[model samples]
Target chain A: MKKVLFAMALALAQTAWADGGMDILKSQCSSCHNLTGPAPQTLKELWARKGPDLFYAGNKYRKEWLVQWLQNPTRIRPAGEFYEDHIKPGEKHDEIDPATLKPHVSLSKDDAQAVADALMTLKPKSDLIAKEKIEEGTISKSMGEMVFDKFLGCMACHRIEPDYGGLSGPELYTAGDRLQPEYIASYIRSPQAWDPKIWMPNKHVSDMNIQKLVHYLEALSQENKNGK
Target chain B: MGNKLIFLTLLALSLPALAKEAARDNYRTYCVQCHGMAGNGKGVNIRDMSVQPRDHTDAKAMSARSDDTLFKVIKEGGLSIDKSVLMPPWGDTLSDDEIRDMAQYLRTLCKCKFGGN
Candidate 1:
């Protein structure tokens, strides 16, 4: 029995190493990405030219989130990842087939784990992690509304009932019906978890302001129904 | 009475200078795809999305939101502010000052505010 247990442990460790082994990463992800540390700078520039920079794949995004996004190529960034050059209005753009996404490509559990593990090690040269204490404010309806529109710029992408700010983001008219307050707060603080290639402008909001905004956004669903 | 009127006129004329600067470049870099150049919400990316982007040019929707609400969404994100998972948080990419500038530009595109359209 002890021999069996020891064998099992060895198998698991070997399996773990096998999946993330540099060999697999080179075979799979190297075509688009460099598997080695300090990914090639020229590759970074080319990706930025064509799309978003993936050099910091590990530190910039969560593993679960990366799995989901890799499968579904949703336009998390309202604008193209690099730049927006539209000297004209109403120009036509091509669409991507949802079925053709990378996520749809089947991978063995081992291979998936291996790729996820390898990808997570890539970090950018710049420090992006925020460490300051965010100020906390009393969460209230009026204040939330104020912060949503005036202070924080929620209206830019979301459509909350009466006001629609911008489309580059998402529809917020039913946020209260859709999300939890804590989820809202965490997402507000760091959106990269959902998508590493996001093009949204990062505005450093204090924690207090984030709380107030979440409180107000969460109430949108309940308040409207109750006629508040 | 004349002097008072002149001072008032001067103040009114200079108010546009104090008016929040709009960082259109930020908007272009970050928002123009879905929101479009006009803030109509029909950006190049709209066609592929499951849901159509909201039209910001609509006065009815613009009037309901206050400037603070807009700011919150921009700084945190659509999901963070209970807006949408599709809209990622910009809090890390831009500064508060830059976001405010973008908000001011958004107001210009929509041609309306919290109360008036």
Candidate 2:
């Protein structure tokens, strides 16, 4: 009788926390995040989007990173969510008006945990993965930088460090900690496949170099943690 | 009747110029991030960019390319013209008429008409 009761308790436990998590998500997160989505299918939808699509957070993010970020909260996009939104003409060059940007909302620790749990349950694009197993392969520091800057020209937008690269894309120093390796590779391979109208171009990076890029991102993330 | 005719004539003359003026807004919105507020290729984002944004004000250089080439580049992307991918395609964002006006606006910036290569 104890064993049967324990079995029932285990089953209830699996759903108990998730129910709380789902409630928190529906209440707080659904306003900005697309919790249930076929990701913005048109340019109009893309422009109308308020926050990053969380429908695939399970496939995209690391849970620990998500929880920590939700509690602390930071601006990921240097030029705001849509680069065109807050831009104004300055005397020298066009500037992103700091006054116009509203930072991501921070949640309390308990709320963050529930939100992260709910987010991790969303994996809409599981099929978008490496055809073969991909690992974080090695890349020489110079060669990796060359591939990022010269060969591929990712420095035109993405930044490896703070205040370093172009402002249009998200900072990449914490990419490894923030994103899963498979997610990174899959994204670089075909950004359009995931966010069809997203400005990130399909570079057609070779498989070997894709692994190298993943390794580079992981190393950069480590360097950030080490205070470099 | 004379005043009305004059007003219509002036409006007709200014229509193309008005279109170019309108395209300047698009330029300010999209291109100015990398192409500079003055189209001098000294955009704020150029500080870390390995490749420089093309200076629309470079008359001698701008005259070498035709309007068709310029339109293609703006619509398709720089990669479409064997240029850098840093100049992203605007086909999805800007309409065909807007892009055509952008090409026209670039001509105004250079102050030299492209007769073809």
Clashes of each: 45, 0
Minimal lDDT window, size 10, model 1 chain A: A38-47
TM-score of chain A of 2: 0.91
Per-model chain A TM: 0.46, 0.91
How is the predicted docking of candidate 1 categorized under the CAPRI scheme? incorrect
Q: Give per-residue CA lDDT, model 2, range A1-228, as digits (tens).
A: 999999999868756766788898888878878888877655456667767888899999999998899999887888776676666667756677889788888888877877787788888788886453576367766788787877777887788888788876788889989998999999987786677656565666788878888888888888889996
For model 2, the stretches where C-alpha displacement exceeds 4 angstroms are: A1-11, A130-132, B1-33, B36-44, B57-60, B71-85, B88-113
Residue A215 shift from truth in candidate 1, angstroms: 9.3
TM-score of chain B of each: 0.73, 0.79
Model 2: docking quality category: incorrect
On DockQ, the candidate that comes out on top is 2
TM-score of each candidate structure, all chains considered together:
0.40, 0.78
The single-chain TM-score for chain B of candidate 2 is 0.79
**Winning candidate number (TM-score):** 2
